[model samples]
Target: MITPGQKIIQEWYKVKEWRQFPFQQEMEATYLAGYSGLLNAPTGSGKTFALFLPFLADFINKHPDYKTRKNNGLQMIWLTPLRALTNDIKKAMQEVCDDLQIPWKIATRTGDTSAAEKAALKKKLPEVLLTTPESLHLMLAQKEYPKIFQTLQVAVIDEWHELLGTKRGVQVELGLSRLKNLTPTLSKGEGANEQVVKDKVPRFYTTDALNWNANIDNAKQNRRQPTEAENVLWQFLRGKKIGYKFRRQHLVLRYIPDFICIEKKLIVEVDGGYHNDAEQQELDKYRENELIAQGYTIVRFTNNEVLTNPDNVLSKIKQILETKSNSLPEG
Candidate 1:
């Protein structure tokens, strides 16, 4: 079904006196389907519009009153392989934003981008950031970078064919890995199921296989080799530092959570990059449903969150604990 967002895009095209291309429509459909893919066409075949307008559609659909809404954090990252292309790309994107009065702040962060501009981004990120692969790595390298990307809905890598198989391509891959870790839903294509099965299910399987002995073994292994994120959070929770004892890699029914406070019935999960995959997300949903059904409160944090901003993570957990405590029955 064509979404209200798609319909809005259709209206925009009519207003601009432009005809929609078949590929553009396909791209919109794919995007609305919650899948990612590489779009290929000639340099000037309205390729940018194909991807970008759909994003606008999605945004409009989500926030119908977007015009008056407060500035949201970065929602999109446009990674072009070449620094020279930033201006043209930004102009094209900005035109759409301007024409629609979308109030989106589109900025470039290439080698040529100024220090003042970079500093400004740290203070308040734009709605869309256009940058090179190298610049993207720089953003990823910054402390507490995960917060900037928490609201990121999409990362569009332009000219994938140009970057593929080169060293720059590898940089893009590495950078995307970090971004995907922060925003797991920003991913593409198959082979995820295999990775999910081999890497994820063994440690925290959530299916109806009530193999308590196997789960116990898995929990032990996980606790022994806690992920960096899990380990960092554990240090705070270990000695009842937050006024409640927490067990690491504790078994909860048919699943294993990173940390659990039995007294508060709270489960804190630290998700790795693998959890971002579509199949693993489904598994996570199932796992969370099961936990919630059993009177457990689940709070999840990405690996980047725990590693980069542990204090913020701690504060949030403490807040949850306080709220849960306040709701307790009278003695």
Candidate 2:
């Protein structure tokens, strides 16, 4: 049986001709299981959706009448390290929400936002707000800060490694502490909800168990065996290639790439003859565009190239990885 989250994901894949990656499914399951931990995945690995999708599924399931619910309070807060990333996150989330027909609103609050925009957000809060740590701290300073976050369901810290071991990271910690205090009833391990669970079936586990199990089953259904072309490329890209780790048959959101180097945010797709079909080419374009939106540098090679001129393919990949490494910000 397909679960509600899987159903929604299927619809998304149908529209995009994509498949969800294994790590994304695991993240969704972990979130639904009521566990919070650091997501150490590289950029362009669909971490945003991994966190966002479960929250969306839970919100929709719990509040079927979310459209009728009061939209005065914030629902989720996404904190990113760079102000430039705010718009990218907002656009990506809005696209998903629109695709799912969820009437949630998304906005950004960063150092670069206009005063007028900030004032409007103050009056009517969006359901999802993407902001930087400094901007978040500023919001916490406001008199109505607690009320603003009263309805917040989740807080996603993006590019966490960039902020770790810094004063800004400490500020985020303090802000979360304050949010916890304001919503004592919603505190992680507080209150008397155990009695309600005890009154239910004796063998029942948390709803997380149901979600996790459903996701596991859904992943099995989506898994596919690699093609001969994919098999060839995997042999070359797998393990360590020039000191960087590469994953084969890796999943990103709703599509699998033949080869991916997470550190460089690079994806290599080995295409077969069928990819030349008009419809198939169209679908491939859609897939590549979506991946590019997540900051991935996509490279494509024909099956012939991978099987015959393998050295050229390896050289091309090595050059791209080296270029990306040199462009990385100095620590």
Tell me each candidate's RMSD, in Å, in order.
15.8, 17.6
> Looking at model 1, which ten-residue stretch has the lowest summed lDDT?
201-210
lDDT of each residue in 251-321, candidate 2, tens digit only:
56544566778778898878777466443454467668778887889999998998889899989989998
Residue 165's lDDT in candidate 1: 48
Which segments of candidate 2 are over 4 A away from where they belong?
A: 67-72, 184-186, 189-331
Expressed as tens digits, the lDDT of each residue in 127-243 for candidate 1 is: 999987767766765667878887888989998888764434655765665565565445334422123332332221122232455456556766677667777889899989999
| Model 1 residue 209 lDDT score | 35
Whose TM-score is greatest here? 1
- Relative to the true structure, candidate 2 reaches a TM of 0.56
TM-score of each candidate? 0.57, 0.56
Model 1, position 325: C-alpha lDDT score: 55
Whole-model lDDT values for every prediction: 0.77, 0.70
